[model samples]
Target: MIRRILISCGIAFVTLVANAAPDDSIKVVKGQVSDYYITVTHERIVKGRVLDKNHQPLEGATVMFFASPMHSTTARDGSFAIKGADNDIHLYVYYPGKKIVNKILALDENNLDIVMEDEAHKATAVRRPAQATRWYDPQAPLSRTFCNPVNISYNFEPFNNNVRPNGSFRSSADPMAVEYKGEYFLFSTNQGGFHYSKNLVDWEFVPASFQRKPTDDDQCAPAAYVSGDTLFYTGSTYEGLAVWYSTHPKTGRFKRAIEKNVLPSWDPCLFLDDDGRLYLYYGSSNEYPLKAVELDRNDFYPVSKIHDVMMLRPEEHGWERFGMNNDDEVTLRPFTEGAYMTKHNGKYYFQYGAPGTEFKVYADGVYVSDSPLGPFTYQKHNPMSYKPGGYVQGSGHGGTFCDVKGNYWHVSTCMLSLKYKFERRIGLYPVAFDGDGVMYSSSAFGDYPNWAEPMDIKKPADRFTGWMLLSYQKPVEVSSIDSIYTAANLTDESMRTYWAARSGNPGEWAQVDLGAVKTVRAIQLNFYDHKATQHNRAMDIYHQYRVYASEDGKSWTLVVDKSDSDKDCPHDYIELSEPLRTRYLKYENVHMPTGHVAMSGFRVFGNGDGDAPQTVKGLTVKRDKKDRRSAFISWQPDTDAYGYNIYYGIAPDKMYNAITVLGQTEYDFRGLDADTEYYFTIEALNENGRSPLCKTLKY
Candidate 1:
């Protein structure tokens, strides 16, 4: 006999199983059973994972068992489970705005995997109803600044719904960012254009003024560096990878000189050492090591033999291996590209991005050498730039620069692309050098909007200010919404899906209810460019909106007013000068870049749950003889922690030195004296406060 059970969200169900032992991981419980050989509930169960077409886990997906009301959600790993009461049970996997996935299990089947198709894959004429679940895009279209791809003329999809793999909204890979005259500028290989940001928070698209004819090769991975007052640029091929220069970066035009062969290069950058010497670093591909050669001072061309700095070694480094989990074993070797170098405190730090441009784990790693041309050693904490879990993903192929405040910041690629393997977006992270001279980029809340000011102090203990997520899955109301483009999407936390007004008319608004009154610290009004047509910077004023907060659902008060603000911030983050308490929040749209009144997140961040993180524990330190300059430190992470601080030195009592590892539990101690006895401890920090130090360790 088979029994069918049903349960909904937050509901519980009990099932009988004559299992050898109950599995608590999925809440498999047992009930009355027969004796030994005649156990009434003979062990039988079905469990598996829900994945997208790309084989990536679909977290937070809702799974329902057919006929049996019992079901479990897909975990971060995408696994779901249900009691197997019969030989045939249909399982349905659903994500908001995505196509529904169904699978059936027959007898003798213990594992069933389901892959969900994106509604985008289906034609608009045959689309399903809106399930406004996710807050971000799935493919992660890499088109922030110059979404336009170079070879856009040769595409299959003339009309793509996602707009990511399509024209203008295409790949903008290798965001070579630099600070020039107090403004941040990004050049990429995708569109052969550039982007400029006055505050590192709002990037505006600018056309490639230098290249009149948009030849795909000329714009690929353009390199720029300030030589005295002139900015030198090169990359992509034309007769000889010609050198271009312009005193004004924002002007977007470069004066191209018809010089000759500067050594066939890929992913290249010109680095100026403090001593007035010029060196060139370039190469990208598993076939070649990231090589460096000295550039002549007079003409800025390669003057010496190239030195192979480093190569891809996925066989040893798991992070450099390709695949969603970096465990896929196949024919082709991994890729190593995006070479960048920075000199700090007389030490040369060479950074490289790797493992192909398509992987989620794609990141930037580092190597250290005393000389510009080096026998460089890989830093134990490789992939120094990483943020795989954020709304936007990859952080590889980026540029490191010092802000006007003398603080270090890394601007790397984020978001994603599907039309092309290199489809990507740009992201900024707070970075710092420790007492040991090791450098790290803090990715805590990386995709979240942050302060535009350069932090001159040591990198923040926590990149995120411990702001609790106050409106996740909360009740939402919109003045007007398009069919299926519901209001609840305003607080889903992913940027892929959003709430859209019935039309792009002024006055359309979306509001969120936080359930109860709560203290709000700041609000991130992330507007979306939903299938927007104008790819280039427009003549119209920057996107505009106004925010209001209320104690009850009725009366409202102005909390943040940007109705007249002139800034092109699709991901706009507005920090209130002070914290305010309110149960209801609303956003009124004044105007937008395009016809849709779309919004990804009307996020409310504040201290709703009052409490600091618990103290860190399980501290461990390891010293390896292979590399004498670094120590690897790790500890159990605190769920509530905004970040972790690792303190260490030559003596336990005198361990005054420290480094704050943001959004991660493990940290590599670089610049340490390998032979000296070193002691270390750790502490967890949140917006409220810090926890006590954990047990110390010596090496």
Candidate 2:
């Protein structure tokens, strides 16, 4: 028998208080495990705090799951606790007009700090999906950082020395970024709202203007399209085709375009052709082939039946084949989803994400159709947006939009499925058309803190962040540890192993010694809740830690002090306004939310020696004899190099594009404008910085 469980989630930033005050209005049995969930091998207590966007505690919030009978509520501190079954559960949180949260709770998981935004606090506006009321200004520098799976808090407080911990954390997928009114707005499934920004780097979350709030599945793979003056929105729903429209997304209101389902749509996209026609593309699972249908011009509803548009062929398209390098046999058919359409210079470009969203290689593959609705042909240069080797992966299921600088950017999803199966992040990458009119995504130096093209000031031809490891394999010291967990785990560069203090109390701490004075740029402190059980029910717990640096172990200078901080940061990072020179960095725990001070990454990013990398050797650039548009480039390995960069352009001085490969010595350049002579240069990069460009080669 299926049972429904009730529980709430929130990240409270309120005055410190216990959730001990019980509300007589509702009855809840705390720590009471039930058999409603199957395979109940173990039952654990779940605890967390809920807060509003303003960092205030949300009182009397309700949290529940659709599958279990257990339920919970927030007390005065906007905190809740309930017994969790062995199975994973999705908890739904509701506050006044705030966008609701559908957070996941695994059997062994607890301690959630959820944040909600209050809708009443903002100036709200109503809009239709087909009208656009705003535009972006091109006079400003675009926000440069565009790494996938980045924490939103990371963008708000950019990578700097004075940056604070992430007060809010979220996982969103199926990105749809739209440009309007001199600004860009980003929408994602389960985000409750959309985010807007003048520069792409710094984003502000605003409630979506939807006539009807989305249900669970409806939020999975939503789609958006732009017409003359309207921005149309819809989502995956077998129940019905619920469409929304908004001219001003920043104001957080959308009117219903269609309330009924004319066609069964999932993982959908609404495409409007240049000839004033419209179409819808969808089909999210591997089990089904992708299909399209034409929409009526008047109501924007499906006019006729759905047409079978395309199907997956793993044998032909290796990138579309399941698993990394297309090797998975267990799941024979790869999941073909995230259908998108972009008309570039009269050619219809059809893009879809494949392999699987959860995998590191999750990416987009493109097909070209002469007509908006037609038989499409696959592009030889498949996997339109891919980044397998980076701190973050999975650049798929995202829409492309033009920025104020007229540069095209694809905002895509990043994968971090550990916390939950669908746990994700988002990123943006630059796109350009080669001389052959071939579309290409620039990810060579992707995810790094690279400059954002001409919109951002022109830096070195290679756009690397110049950030190198300062903490990997470094010596670590902790206050005390349990048997298995050790201080060494902190710098082992593995998320699987973590350092767990014997007790999580004020004054407990850990320190990392670089062994010598090194210029430090950033510190990322990742916290892990491993079977943690040391918090009062329904109350907020925040980061009250102190960070200090010292040239020597004894003499310390305060670098980051959160002793009086009210922010909750499970995955915290800090950047100094200016680089700090120190041999030792200490992370002192003033207070912890769970039973012990558990940490996975006490990472540090900076320069060592403040020097450039060794020059690459034996640089060879040979144009593909068979394919003039393609080039084969290779270089000799530099022992101290963390990665290599390949720069190429049609003109000698205009080497506009680059590719950064880590631990690899060779890269094939496909999708180059056919019949164009190219100039090529290479460089090596380490923690310190990139070396000078190698001798240029003409192909």
Candidate 3:
């Protein structure tokens, strides 16, 4: 009699027929089986040595076989060995600061030697498959300080519309950051992927598309929430959306938790209460108020009826009016969106962005309540995060997240709407809640260098590195300039304008005179996309340039060199390893990703030899009786000052809101709570430092 038996091991199964045999041994399998197949197969030990182009053994190199989990790291002698089935296999070799090597080799071919080329020799070496370049070198030491416009590569707009016939400029906005398992993940609109960081300073991009459904947009104003060990994510959609969940986001592996949401939401935010209840807040419109609803944690479906949260009150909230500077209420209505929630000390804070993102006055406002979905009361100090006057403006439509050290940070959208209304960037600021329970985000010196890990959490200003701008309004000379784009635009402190070279060619340069020798600490090179035609995210595009410093106009010393860099940094900020004293700085272009070489700002930051600007003598504050939210403040301008900072709050001791005004003595203070009494102060700033704040005045 013949009998059939099936044996399963792990993922492979084998079917066998038991025919009477003298030995009674298993016969050959009919289906594919695992390595534990009854038949004996020979395994060979594959050995290899990895070396650089110079024939020097590259220690710490990683060697692995493609399509196999087996990997080994080279020892001090750059030799690695792995035992595998005797067959031809694809091998991959990787080393820091070197290009990856991939080759097909026979497992029996032992003592194999592989040569890798340095990134600097990429142009001359044979082209291989493109690999994703990390934002920072993994072998280099982690950075302690970082500058804003946050530094990661922004993605080009993916679609072509009437606004952009070709492709749109690079843009990212409506940011949301969350801390999961000691690492932070950042998500922004239209950036085909997200970025994760162990130290917020060194970020690695993870390519992922959460839009499993048929939709034109990807993750627009995505909502991210961490619960237990898993992180749930979804994007703004008018139709049913999928909620993706990932335990290991670093690997970019996410599975859909909810295939289709029961309700549709735009600009959504997910909040999980301490008691384990989940809620969602969403809205992005000028005609409607933000809405909220309780959700079932298991199924991620709404359990309670939608509740009307809050709407734009432009008549009483000056900052809510729609305009470039909150001054266009007559023609345009304000937009209320970007809903976020943070529960602290038993009170729930509902934060939302107001006005318009296309304007410099884009800011975030907050309301306090005792319940997740309730009648929330407006916070007296409105626009909790505002940076209307800075190198990069707009501090709205973002999420607040806490780091591992319990420090709170607000990552918001910074406007760069010159190319399209959606063109934008992201900025991070220190957030704190005082003893009185008033929450605020510090934007003073917002665009300057700030500490990634602050020294003190109580003092929000401690985040600033005390690096003053030394290149603002300084004299500049360029090799060639287009008639429409003047050289003066380089130091004009505006992202909307730029100085373009006659051509995007090598050796084109721009030199800036600091007027006097000053101690230089950091430099920020803001490159502009002047006539760029890229419509999609181009990973291979990069920028290469060199910066030099000079004490005298003639003798120059190399300061920052990136001639062979394969990474793209449109808004590149470099902190020198050591401080240098120089009065003149020059930026020489080696390569441009596309279009003419253009720069919005070549900002230098450090201390000046001279004293700080003097405090203002004449100060005035006039509150509008018709609309209590409006006020007019002016101070006597300091002759030696390049800018001024206006500080105001509900009380003298609670002065947290600051607005950095450049080359202006008067400001139309229009963001205030109608019933709150306020105090105001002003201080002058120059290349050296800031003056002592003027005496606090009550209004």
Pick the lDDT winner: 3
In candidate 2, what are the lDDT values of residues 524-622, reduced to their tens digit? 787765445322111255666778888979998777766655444555645455678889999998777655788877877778885677778889977
| lDDT score for residue 336 of model 3 | 92
In the range 1-699, model 3's lDDT, one tens digit per residue, is: 223244444333344445553332334333445222243345667887888888888888988878887788988888889766656378888887788888887545677888999874445435332222222222353377777898877877765562355344788999989999888899998777898877776676787865444324568999999988998998898887889998887777889888877777899999999999999999899999999999998888899999999999888788898888777878867999999999888999999998999988899999999999988999988789999887989999988988888888899999988877888999989898888899898998789988885344556788888889998888999999977898999998998888999899988999999998889888889988777766556677789887888889999877776776787788888777667889999999988998889999888899998898888878899999988878988988799999988998888988888888998889987777677788999889998888999899998
For model 1, residues 1-699, the per-residue Cα lDDT tens digits are 323232445454755445435422233223422212222344457788888889999898888767766667889999987675554467677886579877666777778788888785554343332221122111231122111111111111112343434443324567676778777767776443577766554456655643333233336677878867787777755246677778875667777654654577778877988888988888878787888999887776677887999997665565677664354558567788888999999899999987767765678888999999998998765567865543456677888888788878776766455334554556667677777777777664565434444434555434455565676678998988777778887877555567878777768888899888887766677665555555432345366666777898789877655555555556565555556878998888876767588876777777664577787888888776685545677889788775676766555654544555556788654434444566788878654556788877888
Error of 1 at 235 (Å): 3.5
- Lowest lDDT 10-mer window, candidate 2? 129-138
The C-alpha RMSD in Å for every predicted model, in order, reads: 20.7, 15.5, 14.8
TM-score of every candidate relative to the true structure = 0.64, 0.64, 0.79
For candidate 3, give the lDDT of residue 95.
89
| Candidates by lDDT, descending order | 3, 2, 1
**RMSD of candidate 3 to true structure, Å:** 14.8
Better of 1 and 3 by lDDT: 3
